[model samples]
Target: MKNIETTLRNVGTVSLVGAGPGDPELLTIKAVKAIAAATVLLVDDLVSPAIVALAPPGARVIHVGKRGGCKSTPQAFIEKLMVMAAREGETVVRLKGGDPFIFGRGGEEVEHLRAQGITVQVINGITAGLAGITSLGAPLTHREHAHGVLFITGHVRPGDSDTDWRAIAATARDARLTLVIYMGVRGSAHIQEELLTGLPASTPVAVIQHVSLPDQRHALTSLGQLHSTIERDQLTSPCVIVVGDVVRGVAAARAPEALRRIA
Candidate 1:
């Protein structure tokens, strides 16, 4: 038992880290420690440059960017690099944007590491969905307007079943749930169409782009005007789409004629 414990102690560890939104100040104390102590960092595309600068001067930094609709480093290659580094007795950190577990593919990386007998741990960070809604000074779930909150993805992996937006709209309407959709910009029109089948055309919605960053922008509109609003605002990928009456919770989201101006 003592010998086994000693052997494990000498093995290098891998930390799956969440880099928060774009703000470096949002970093957790533990995340900072892990990053500062890292020997190698596998950084995601959306991770803030400021956060990457937190690594020790001698620490190796490698960008393994994975973005929607863009050329990116292959996931298989990234995982392979992690395993190689850990077995070579290097402390590896996989830095991802937002919370590691929230659609960051941290789970798949963790499984791959564990299968290779590498020690791994995950440090939590603020998810973009929460940050995006909060940036608008609105709660995802309001006791009066929303009783539940659904954090769903607008994108799906290959060979995986696609999301049923219409059915989701039906459930959200009947249950008074708020929907936070990530990676949903390209599909906004189709989502809006299906959602309108079950939800009201006038349902309040907010599309927040680059949430928590200096370039952050948002537009408040109705479900019926979602796609048009996104187009008019020129909102692109990496945006969070908050749908439901909870959007109306924001003073800026409220309107006399039921169409608050988009920014």
Candidate 2:
């Protein structure tokens, strides 16, 4: 090992890496490189264990759980830990699930680190909403079905104002867009009701759980039955909820197989 003073002076770098949607193979080559070079890793709860295991055997791994609606390690604390580790001249990696910029709080971490003059690099990974829908063979945006796609978080921060779902539903309906909601299972009923005011009750909806994993499961339902389907299927957190005409493609694609079996 290098001398402590030399190590401290040479080290001090932080990489904010996206671990992707629960698949180790989905990790970007740059992300893997950052992991391999890390002397300290600050891992988020949603990051897959397989990716975490890629860290060097001697790297210190710290779990900074940030799951929604659960007791979480405070963001400020996590930021402090990163600063501390990096300032000590250790190569640090803040591993988060999905693209750090997309609802991953990666921006905040980057801001905090930069404020303290720490050098930080970002490595992008596939987000769950994108990966989840594709896993079902549905495109997020199709020229014939959807004009665009919107990604939103289902949970509102505590003490903050709630999202105007009614307005969003109207916009989505008018824009012919696909809606992908993350961290939405708990408030699914309310979301379904508000969306119904704008979207047709027959609009296709898909709830994908454990997306891209070996045990992944999904359910297809209409807007009217979205809540009921989730409850009946016992779908829980870490699921992606997709709504809009893009889902029709999933049904249409499966129809041929279904008809063949029937025949």
Give the candidate number with the greatest TM-score. 2
lDDT of 1 at 34: 98
Clashes of each: 0, 1
User: Which ten residues in a row are the worst by lDDT in model 2?
Assistant: 254-263
Quote the positional error of residue 75 for candidate 2 in Å. 0.5
Question: lDDT values of the candidates?
Answer: 0.90, 0.90
Tens digit of per-residue lDDT, candidate 1, span 1-263: 99788766777889999999879989899999999999999999899888999999999999999998999899999999998888778999999999999999999999999998999999999999999999887899888999999999988877998799889999999999999999999989889999999998988898998879999988888888999999998999889999988887675555544444322
Candidate 1, position 84, lDDT: 87
Residues 32-84, candidate 2, lDDT per residue (tens digit)? 99999999999999988899999999999999999988899999999999999
Which parts of model 1 have CA positions greater than 4 angstroms off?
1-10, 252-263
**What are the TM-scores, per candidate, against the unseen true structure?**
0.93, 0.93
Q: Name every residue pair that clashes in candidate 2.
A: 12-89
